[model samples]
Target: MKNKTLLTVLSIIGMGLLLGWFILQMKPPHVNEKSTPSANQQAQTKTNSPEEKYIALTPEAQQKAGIRVKVAGPVQIKTVLELPGEIQFNENRVAHVVPRVEGVITAAYKHLGAPVEKGELIAVLESRELADLKSQYYTAIKRRELAQITFDREARLWREKVSAEQDYLAAKTALAEANIVVTAAAQRLLALGLTQDALDTIPQESQSKLSRYPIRAPFDGRVVRKHVVRGEAVKADAELFMIADLSTVWGTITVYTEDLNQVHLGQKVTVRSEELGLEATGTISYLGYLIDAQTRSTQAHVDIPNPEERWRPGLFVTVEVAEKKIPVPVAVAAEAIQTYRNQPVVFVQHGNGFEVRPITLGRRSGNGQWIEMVNGLSAGERYAADNSFVLKSELGEAMAPQ
Candidate 1:
């Protein structure tokens, strides 16, 4: 009984030993301590080695891409007040030509868009009314001539004592009355736009020409409107032609009540037409005292020299009034800015290439040609100024999934 109990104990011990050996074989081998890393160490390694993105190009390639580089530095930023406006004729230089006398249009010498010099004949009129006025002037002159001859005879009779004093005085009074009538007739013709030279020639002019009257231009300008045609009967006050001296034009700006305080006469203004690609600079010359009731706005005009006449009247334009000027430490050309990953960025010059740098923007210039860099850029750093889109396109292609 003792031997059997001992055997059972031995068998139990042997089974325990076999199970321990099996566990040892299945376990992994131990590694060197120097080859293994801790959790913190692994995380730190990942953090330190981040993927950097950039574009690589040569100087020749950049030039071929039409990329222009400029140094970032202090820039004069303009605070602009923008307003809507339209090009209009300078009212001071415009004229509404009218005939002073009622007449029929014998000829229309000037047409729309025709240029004329001062005192140039623009039209002719034939009127019996003008003829009657000329006849009265000539009749008065003939009566004055007869009176002068009688006055000479009467003066001689008075001086020589050969005639009665009452007769001589009567003849002298008649002559004086006739001279007054002649003076009145001459004044009447002078008031009808007839020059002194014209009056002197009227008596020598043919009777048919006595009815002819010429309408002349008041100044050097272009005919903008023609209201009369050949054979058309026009009234005395009718506007026959509209002439405008287009050497200068007016850019009429509508100033809202909110912008009134910022606008004033003599302020520098720039007028721009995006569609026509036209631009001009001038100073504010006029401001309206009364505000428009419906628009709740006042008008201001800038007199711009339009020697080329490119600034046509009635063209809608944008007026930018320079309110103030500010100097910024860092600024870049507006065209240099680009959108990347929904963020505003600029291409900064790197060694042999450029790197995309995100930036914070501040105020823009009044001309919209420059932008202030609040951050992510430094003054004196070279950057892409013109055609920066080329760099952006290259970056996009390089980062795109293959």
Candidate 2:
């Protein structure tokens, strides 16, 4: 019975050894730690393998891929074209009020910004020259009266043959020459702005003769500039007042040479002012023949109505000139554009990756949202529509010196 029990225990131990050997060899033949897992290898009852190298995932890249993409599309560029400039006055309508004769400015009746009408008295001038002319006129008038009385007597004598014809002719010549003298003196007084009524009053009020000259406003306008004061000597034809008709002022549109073609005479223009929040409608009145040397721009002038006197001569304002529109080729979105050092590139998607391409830009469309391309990008072409700037940075880092 002991020999039979020992035989049974040895038999059980032998079975256990056989089972362990089979389990060890059951792994696929030639299968090793270095081998890549095949489709059939994963089907094994128990197996462990390292991941494939090409398909290996970095933590950073995995996190990036898991994040939601920012959705973007083409936004057309248009409007809000801010052309800079200042306001100006109408050159044709503006006028300067100056004194006609040299004199001392005795009065400053008009304020610097006061409104005045045509022929309204502005100031008075005390002039010695004017007084001298008046004196000459008074002397000539008295001499002319005496000559007339003498001529009447000579005519009566000639008609009765009581005197010789030569005697009468001599008197006639003397009277004629005296009249010419009177005429010359009268012209001097007229040149000095002596009115007919003033001349008549001069002889009766000879003792009241004075040296004052009245200056009148030449036109209906507001006094924008003043160059005279009481007791100040004013020169002849010197600009004492810069009077301007603010009823209408200039709204100048300074368009570049490239945009000059878009404007024409009589084109409707709208002008707005910030000071008074006033809007004035005007028409293109003049187109400048020459371009500004500094700005390289041409001025197109519009005549704006300013009945409320809100828009003054020098207030800065804006002019909106509608330009002609034209269609152009544009790459739908800004995301397609990438920069490579000094050049612009577009990442055109190819297969599963992308390739950078250089492109030329044209006029801005969607005002600035989408830029028009002169060359390179095309419609309906698949491209890296987002994160193009990221690709640009990568290209820069790659091209850096080692």
Candidate 3:
């Protein structure tokens, strides 16, 4: 009876062990599932390389950051070249005033910075040479008058057969010689810049005023420089004053060798000065044919009208010249482009997220508000037009060395 009881207990334990093993086999195996990645990690993974540059941003986040998206479309872009420039006096309107005669400066009617009109007297001088010429003129006039009286009396006598013909002929020859001397003296005074009116008036005026020389302005302009002072002696060729017409000026740009082909006469240019808060538009008036050996550049002159004389000479400025206009199939706002690793890029909207896209750019508009896409973009593609810098910053923060 004890053996049979033990056997039964063993059989029951064996059945229980089998049942537990089968139940365990029937249950599912445990696995470690991965957690969801954060938005930054996902963006980094998308933009790991240039070929795969992309950013994943939620719609709500994009809206909160003021990111605006627009479709790339056709645009007309002008090829523009910007270069440093300077404002200068128009050489055509500049005058280097000279005395034209040796004299002692008696009075300076116009000083530096004084505006003068055409033909206005600017200075007065006393000349000894002029005094000598006036004396000669007066002596010649008196001699010619006496010769004329003699010739008239001799001619009357000969006509009436009262005087020898040889005597009358001699008197006529003397009168002709006297007239020649008078004409020669007058021409000498004319060469001294004495007008016919001045010559006629000098004979009627006092001898003391005959030596006075007046220097007149050549054009309507302001005296920029005065080289003579009162009581100073000056030579005939001495520069007395420098005058310039400020109504028009020049904006000169240095064009390099590579740019010589693009810049030409009559091309439109826009000039701006940041320091003076000034802007003006002009046309290219002149182009240098020879290049500067030292600078490897040539000059391009633009004529800028300054009716109010606001643009002063020697002011530094910038010039923008539009070389050509081209029609582009795809273009975007200039603000949409961003630099990544020295390459330009734009953000394209992909579903609810944004993808960073690399782009090749062509010519930019004259005003620099728009840019033409040479490649890596297509028309009708939606991109972040404004505030795209936000995505760039976020991506940069995520990719920074941690």
The TM-scores of all predictions, comma-separated, are 0.83, 0.57, 0.74
Best by TM-score: 1
Q: For residues 1-402, could you state the per-residue lDDT of candidate 3 as single tens digits? A: 999999999999999999999998895865544366778877777657654556778888988999999999999888778888999999999999887789999999988899999999999999988888878988899899999999999999999999999999999999999999999999989888788888777668787898899889989999999999999999989999999999999999999999888888998889999999999999999999888899999998999999999999999999988778889899999999999888899988888777778899987898888899989889999999889999889778766789
What is the TM-score (0 to 1) of candidate 3? 0.74
Q: Which stretches of candidate 1 lie over 4 Å from their true place?
A: 1-52, 58-69, 164-169
Error of 1 at 55 (Å): 2.1
Per-residue alpha-carbon lDDT of candidate 2 for residues 89-169, written as tens digits (9 for 90 to 100) = 677767777666788887989988899898799988878877777777778888878878877888899999988888788
Which of candidates 1 and 2 is the stronger one according to lDDT? Answer: 1
Residue ranges of candidate 3 with Cα displaced over 4 Å: 1-29, 35-70, 83-85, 255-257, 274-277, 289-300, 338-360, 374-377, 382-402
- The residue-level lDDT of candidate 3 at 307 comes to 93
Ranked candidates (TM-score, high to low)? 1, 3, 2
Residue 111 miss distance in model 2 (angstroms): 1.9
Each candidate: what lDDT?
0.90, 0.69, 0.90
